[model samples]
Target chain A: MSGAGEGPGHGLGGRPTTGARTRSIAEAAWAAAGRDGERNGHGRTRLQWLMARFGRGTVIGIPYIWLLLFFLLPFLIVLKISFAEFRIGLPPYTPLLEWIEGGYLQIKLAFGNFLFLLDDPLYVVAYLNSLKVALVSTLIALLIGYPMAYAIARASPTWRAVYLLLVILPFWTSFLIRVYAWIGILKNNGLINNALISLGLIDSPLPLLNTEVSLYIGIVYSYLPFMVLPLYATLEKMDIALIEAAADLGCRPFKAFLTVTLPLSMPGIVAGSMLVFIPAVGEFVIPDLLGGAGTLMIGKVLWSEFFNNRDWPVASAVAIAMLIFLVIPIVVFQYYQHKHAERAEES
Target chain B: MTDTLVQGTHSASSRPEGSRPGAVLRRAEARPIIEIQDVVKTFGDFVAVDQVSLTIREGELFALLGGSGCGKTTLLRMLAGFERPTAGRILIGGQDMTQVPPYDRPVNMMFQSYALFPHMSVEANVAFGLRQDSLPKAEIRDRVRQMLDLVQLGPFAKRKPHHLSGGQRQRVALARSLAKHPKVLLLDEPLAALDKKLREQTQLELVGIQERVGTTFVVVTHDQEEAMTMADRVAIMDSGRIIQVDTPHALYEYPNTRYVAEFFGTVNMFQGQLIEDEPDHILIRSDALANPVYVGHGISARGGATVWVALRPEKLAISRVQPDSPHNWDQGIVEDIVYLGGISTYHIRLDSGALARVTTQNLERMAEPDITWDDRVFVSWRHDNTVVVTG
Candidate 1:
């Protein structure tokens, strides 16, 4: 069956009918058919042969299959569960479809779970709070990371390596451990409060822990390296002569930075902002540990619905809603990113 | 013969500065617009520039010619106020600019890489300097248009730097640097990045623009031909010091040392002790020459002192038969011949094992030359064509 597809590929590749070339082509076709046969039935080898006519199709199809199995399949299952009714059973959810006696099918979808979210103000507040936290933390990370990246990029080659290592040094430790370490520094009786008290800057310990400030500090600290690395990659590639040319044309140092350095590093800024903002919106650890009980975020609400309340259907609905909410911004961001990339390539 | 040599040196030394090429003196005397006074720059234990002083007249195109790491760039940077000299003062238009920052200094530079802002359009890049000065919007727009037209990049004004070709980007950079109308314009290897044909064309354009603007221009370049083509006066620099500064013609004709002579063009050196120092001529006897070589130039060196007589390759004439001249002539066998279309250079191996190069113009086109490999020929130069250096 594979031999049928090889006829056209042989002509297209213009491969000589040497023993080695023929053997390699045969092996590739066999391997592709073997993989396809495992998924579809073995009797469908002729179909696989037709699909494999263009050898490049098989190579391109591998990544599509991987994405389907790993990402789309799991997502569809969660989406299916979101429409099922919650029940105390082995699977803990009612079947979405049932066959009636008279050859008719009845589909039972528990859209009440989705309606319950709109009815309850808690979920809406949690989503709003998540977006606010994510936006604020990303801004803080950008503000701190930009200068460090610029300084590292402008540093001499030997010193540049040292500074870059320092930026990545926090990653050497486990991420949870790094987050936990921040707790000690931000607590009411932590080193910062103790030092401030000793310096007479404060009479007593401030409410430093279990607050939005602490949560922001933790999020910014963890995601700073992500911001700095990308910004440095862009800033390091920038020509320093651009700044000199600006200065030579009567621009002051700071104005030169705003005009030349800042605009040129926009790609890095966008990348770094997305890197910090995306994961931060759904981040559970930092807010769970550092945020006050009053602080509302969707990740915490989803966690409570699944583990504490044991409402699998509602939890899945909440998760689907959160994904939909996140998808809007992500799609918009990706559209702009694609447009920017095309513009850059054209220029 | 020695008297003529002394008279040549005296007349050359007394040649008025106003008579030099590209010299524009308002009065009989030239006024120095830019003064680099005993400038010394050191970089962390390395002396990048030794104590150097130079006076650039108004509207003169000057060139600092040197190889890599020769301090020419350091000197140019100092003039641009990018690097502050560790020891000396820089004065422009009679105002001390030693302590002034680059932004405040009335000078601008065109970088060698043509660093046009990639994000900005050609017109915006040209307007950048004017915007920095907080100029009025209408005036900035007018200046940008005028400058872009000056570089003939008006059509490309709306295009980003990456969209423009290399030569167009260079012109945009030139427009941007000149938009501010700086008192002194420093060009760092302005034509270095251009291709051969474009570079030759741009060289003339650069000279024309400089003359039209009448800005005191200082260009730093390692290419001798580039310096010779564009500059009125060329400063030959080596290591961390200036070896000699003179007009291009003078530097080529009367190089003061072996370094300057060899640096400017190809030269054959005959090292010998000075045998006689008569009023009209001097004689140098070297093993490279079968007989003593006569140079119609008397140096300040005493007789018996070691000196070198440098002869340009083009100055030496090769003949199939021995010449009647007794001095400044040698017989050698042609070891190699390089034909370069209009001129052919012959490498001759003399009895003393010294290889001398003689270049002659091909006046008539022939498939075969009169002289070929292994042909014994006489190489001779007129005495007045030779330069004698005692250092």
Candidate 2:
């Protein structure tokens, strides 16, 4: 096909127009042709045919629309609610915008919700405990996942698939059911305590469940796959020659691993940590089910504030504060991702 | 003190008197820096390296040249302590190194992909081995700087491997490997990753570095030209065994077997039988030629035994008329003429239904020959030019 009338300089009928106007006019013409294909006698035009089916904008707009609807919209709603006052009403929160007398608009935003969160020492302790649990669990997951990921990555192709599948196999079960199963394994009369008591390794049933230790175990077990998969991805793609080169340069095998393998897989480490830590910071179900009374986590606090105390505005404020707390790790994760992409492009 | 240290550690141990490039071939008594005794490496049921024994002299740039999967790389890995031989022992500087790990051994390797640490700067990469040795920080810095300067990568000391070009990254890998001044340096396909022009340039630069550092280098390459251009002595391997090991000149001029003759360069093999067996001369009767091929040398073969004569394309002459020598000349019709810029090759189909290739140097301005396709020509070679292989 000749591209005579397709470029920016030319319009139909040898007319001159600006590029944007030309584009709009062309789009209209294409739309008209699409509506009545036999009018032009050459069937539908290429632009009309293609754009009417699927264009670049529609392809790229799909994910944007998804994020806008599901993520940004919900986040804006939460932000708006966080500014409202708590009230004993149907929705249980005062509206930020309201119609007033004298035909004047009244906008009442209560900053007291945020101030109240700062005033309550219980909320502060819960935030700190949440961070502590998330940080400790993430470190534990990394410690356990790195070696497992390394083993899977170094395995043969056939065994590699099997090992990766094994890592993901736990996900096939219901998440809540798996956490409940951990309760059965960690409780005072559960599997470990019974085995230890029968083996004469302990005198009595240990207070294993409903404690901080059990909470750590539950979080680490659930998020360990998240850590291992990304680590495996990076480790599998890494050049094995680098390790060999390190060893050949008079570096011991373990030292080679510490120098080469660990540093190179930093991107995967950051990514996996962010994935586990972000959801973990606001994790609700695990702490609600497995945490003891002393385990004051922000998730449990947020849940009780919204449900038991019926304080939606305060819970929303706590959520917003938790987000502000997590922005640093998210930014760190994004920075590593950007650096990794830049290095990939360079090589 | 520095002078004594430099000489005492590296060149003093490796480089003997008169042990330069060409001179090393004559020094038969030069100390062997690496000795592989009956080394056999197997992966499961498949034997990667058979019972092979090799001795590499100190300060020699040796090449293990072969095609892919020919066990050249496997042998190099065994030398680097990455793979333990299933059965034999390796010695470096007359010490048993078979049971020793790579870090414990005094050897370094430059990977084919260069394998420069993407995270580390050029300086840090070169200093990696030195740091492992727990050298003083000041000494490590000085040696790193010296190594970078040696590879002409001083300006790129702060740059990461990904930030540099392929050639520059290769230089970084070289510098890193050479910084340790190990007893041996193994290079796995060092020039295989570069473009043709850069590969030729790097080949000479590598030889220069090897000589200046005075370290024994064992390089593995599938490219014959790379091996010939860079190696002081090349061991051509095939199918888990070394076919032959000799100087580049000798390997090219006098190949021992048919595989060696064909593998090193282009050759036209004629199936024949030994007709005359004499102390001074031997003659071959061939079905591929109307004439008997004469060699001005004796062979340890009986009469009427089957033999093959290998002649390089450049060694054979093409002419429109027959020469005075009737024993070594044959008449053939030109099937094709390949006019390369520097030289031209003529594919000649002999009357005996055998095809032969003859290359002539295009020395003159009008070197485009008058001889075209279907033109009859005579192909002749001197008796000494023929390489006879019993295998």
Q: Distance (Å) between predicted and true CA of B228, model 1? A: 0.9
- Candidate 1's residue-wise lDDT over A160-259, tens digit each? 9999999989888999998888789988889899999999999989998899888899889989999999899999999988888888888899999998
| A198-282: candidate 2 lDDT, tens digit per residue | 9999999999899988889889988999999999999998999898888888778888888899988988888888889988888
What C-alpha lDDT does candidate 1 achieve relative to the native structure? 0.85
Per-residue lDDT of candidate 2, residues B1-391 (tens digit): 1343344335423543332545655645679999999989999999989888999998888999998999999999988888999999999999999989888888999999988888899899999999999999999999999998787778888888878988888889999999999889999999888999988877777776777888999999999888877777889998899899887777888899999988998999998999999999999999999999999999989999999999999999988988887699899999998989898899999999999999988889965577889999999999999989898
**Docking quality category of candidate 1 according to DockQ thresholds:** medium
Model 2 chain B weakest 10-residue run by lDDT: B1-10
Query: Candidate 1: where are CA atoms >4 Å away?
Result: A1-65, A197-203, B1-28, B366-368
Question: Candidate 2's fnat?
Answer: 0.92
The interface RMSD value for candidate 2 stands at 1.0
lDDT of 1 by residue, B1-391 (tens): 1343234334433444423654433421557889989999999999989989988887878899999999999999998888999999999999999999989989999999988898888889999889988899999999999898778788888998889888888889889989999988999999999999988767767776776678888999999988877787889999889999888788888999999999998899989989999878899998789878887766798899999889999999999878887788998999999989899999999878999999989888755688899999989888899899876
Q: How far out, in Å, is residue B108 in model 1?
A: 1.2
